[model samples]
Target: MTPAPRGSVRQWLAARPVAAGYILAVGSALSYGTAQFVARIAVTRVAPPLVTTAFALLFGALFLLPLGIGHFRRARRAPGKAWLFIVLAGLTAASGVAFMYSAFSLVPLVVASPLGSVYPLVAIGLTHLFLQRLERVTPRLVAGAALVVAGVVLVVVGSA
Candidate 1:
């Protein structure tokens, strides 16, 4: 039997539509969940927000050193467009990780995780409002956002 072509994988992934998005969402959820748990443990011992932030940032950057180096090189080579996106992406990602770890230090994982997961609903709303012209304001998105908000409320109350 002959092996399938490499392009077939790309075609298959594109054909599935929601499968890729679902996979990405699930992966992100697991990653953030684990990170939050770790952050809680770290902050419990350290107890200083700035110290926790510094350790997390230092270790995370060390872990991604290779990628950071490559990004630096790419940014140096590319003139205008690449720097624009690189700066924006770096700022967005840095703020997000810092805030997420900070939140984990302040709240329990059950509360923080659900609150962080609500970002998807925020992204959906932003996309609908600004990026996409054809996408309609659907009841499902509204219901999903409401449910996420309710879940966050429940988590906060239970934790308290």
Candidate 2:
């Protein structure tokens, strides 16, 4: 099918940003989940976890470098606090991936992957702690996080 006019897509995203955000999050989740499977193979069969983590991070940075180039000006103009937070975010994300790769090397993917997916609960708590002014941690959000944890527990138990 022919693509809709370019501005139509932008207008749609602008009109329904929450829906757009969810769509983007789902896409990211799919990519992350698939990457774990591939990482399992690499960590177990091809290389040790540390080596895999390094190469994976290096390749990831390379892949994003071009996209990031366009935003360099905005990133440069960001305040010191913003830069600090950005660095923290990168370090935490890298450490999480490294730990996950280590886990994958030890356990079966069925076990490791689901346990890793519980990051949402951690994210929920952190958001509540740090972003109280920006976003409310409503009961519904807590309940959803609880459900996610419960599902992860079920998956981990069932895979045993």
Candidate 3:
């Protein structure tokens, strides 16, 4: 199939940032899923989790270093609260990865992976409780969240 006209893709995304965001979210999941598979194998090869985690983080940071450079100036000038939240997000990701790696060592990837997806449920519940400004809860979102939880449960139980 011939590709769309040269600038069509950019125009499409510019027209709908929300849709572009969703597309990127799914794309991240695909890359992240592949990375996790590789990390799982590496962890199994190495006995120590810290060593595995360190190597994973180092490689990831190296790969991201150039991309980070593009934002370095803006990041430096970002508000203190923004920096604080950014650090918090990084710390949260690190904690999750540490636990996930440990879990991979302790359990089957099938089990551990599905269990990890349940983090969204925790995030949703926490937001409902702690985040004062949130979008109105609609039936569509409620149903979608229910399906995600159910699907993760089925995946975990099936793997067991």
Candidate 4:
């Protein structure tokens, strides 16, 4: 088959949301991993973890502000419950970042990075407990979580 046009490729991905989610998730992983590595270097050589965290979070919000501005009106119209959850998510994510940066400052990147990445296991448990109505607990998901845990263990242990 001939190659599709560039816009048609984007349309095709958008029409299949699951595939789009996978692609976006991979992109997020690559970006997050690169940021973590750079943050590790910055905290070790340039500044304290708290300073790094502040700048990183600030720049991150600034970077997204333009993209997010268009959605603010819809966000403001969302229910109070949605606002509460959104605030909680922001706080939780901020805390996670602070803790991870602190960890990177204290230990080797190999150990700290893998330990911080165990969030997927926590996500699986939380989704199983709270989001059952929205998403299913598939065998493949469980196996993937298991493999992630095993990889983290190997990384942490091997570093020691």
Candidate 5:
């Protein structure tokens, strides 16, 4: 098919930014999911899980360090407790990633991968407990969370 004119293409994208945004969001999710599968595959070939985890963390930090400098400067003046909490979060994330890597090495990806995604449920619970003011719980939201948990349960049980 002949290509649409460049101006027409730009107009089309601008006219439907919501659609474009959704496509971009899905694309990002697709890329991250593929990375997880690739990580699972890589761990199978490489014996050391921590090495892969360390390298992945190092590379991600190095790549994003520059972009975060502005935020770092802003955060420096925030309350000291906030900085401590951020440090705790960083430690928690690193521990979680390393454990996930180790889990991928020990268990089937089908198991580790789906169970790893249970964080959404955890997030919902945590938000309800700690961030109640930020994220109010509603019937619809509860129903949606229930559906997601049910789906995960089905997948886990079916795979067994």
Candidate 6:
């Protein structure tokens, strides 16, 4: 089939939230795929899992330091009640990264990556339960969640 015109593609991207989300999702998946390969290589050289985990955490924190510093400075002026949420968010993020690295060391990427990819289903379920007033639980979301679960099952069985 002939590709859609460039202007039509641009218009669709501009108009559709789902389209934008899909683009970001693809980009993130590609980066994560590359990261898993790099993690595998790093683990071969570094005997300890913490060594690779520390390096990844340190560099990621360093890269985000400027934004963190700016936010801190702003918070200092008008210290908001959101500080608790911010701290929790940081902890949650750090924990996820550490666990992901630890899992990478223990399991092959084929298994670890699929396990991690199941997070979206978890998120969808949580949102449906907690934020039901904001987001209606529709058939489409249920179908997507089912597909994610099915994909995870396939990945786990195949990896085994």
Stretches of candidate 5 exceeding 4 Å from the true structure:
1-28
The digit string of per-residue lDDT tens for model 2 on 43-118 reads: 9999999999999999999999997899999999999999999999999999999999999999999999889888
For model 1, the superposed segments whose C-alpha errors exceed 4 Å read 1-18, 65-82, 134-137
Give the worst 10-residue stretch by lDDT in candidate 6: 1-10
Q: Tens digits of per-residue lDDT for model 1 on 35-154?
A: 778777877666665577777778887988886785676568788986797789778877776777777777777777777777777778877888778677688878978888898889
Candidate 5 lDDT (Cα, 0 to 1): 0.82
Clashing pairs in 5: none
List all candidate RMSDs to the true structure. 4.4, 2.4, 2.7, 2.0, 4.7, 4.8
Over 4 Å off in model 4, which ranges? 1-12
Residue 78: error of model 5 in Å? 2.0
- Candidate 1 lDDT (Cα, 0 to 1): 0.75
Taking all chains together, each candidate's TM-score versus the true structure is 0.68, 0.90, 0.84, 0.90, 0.78, 0.74
Candidate 6 residue-wise lDDT, 1-160, digit = tens: 3345567766766667686788888998897889778887687666566688788778878988886785776777655567776788788877776777778888887898788877777678888889988988789888988988898899899988
Model 2 RMSD in angstroms: 2.4
Instruction: Write the residue-wise lDDT of candidate 4 on 68-105 in tens digits.
Output: 89999999999999999999999999999999999999
Q: What is the per-residue lDDT of model 3 for residues 10-124, given as tens digits with 9 covering 90 to 100?
A: 7877777897898899999998798778778877886566678777888888999997798899889999999999999988888888888888888888888888877877777
lDDT of each: 0.75, 0.91, 0.81, 0.91, 0.82, 0.78
lDDT value, residue 85 of candidate 2: 90
What's the CA error at residue 61 for candidate 2, in Å? Answer: 0.6
lDDT of 4: 0.91
Which candidate do you rate higher for lDDT, 1 or 3?
Answer: 3
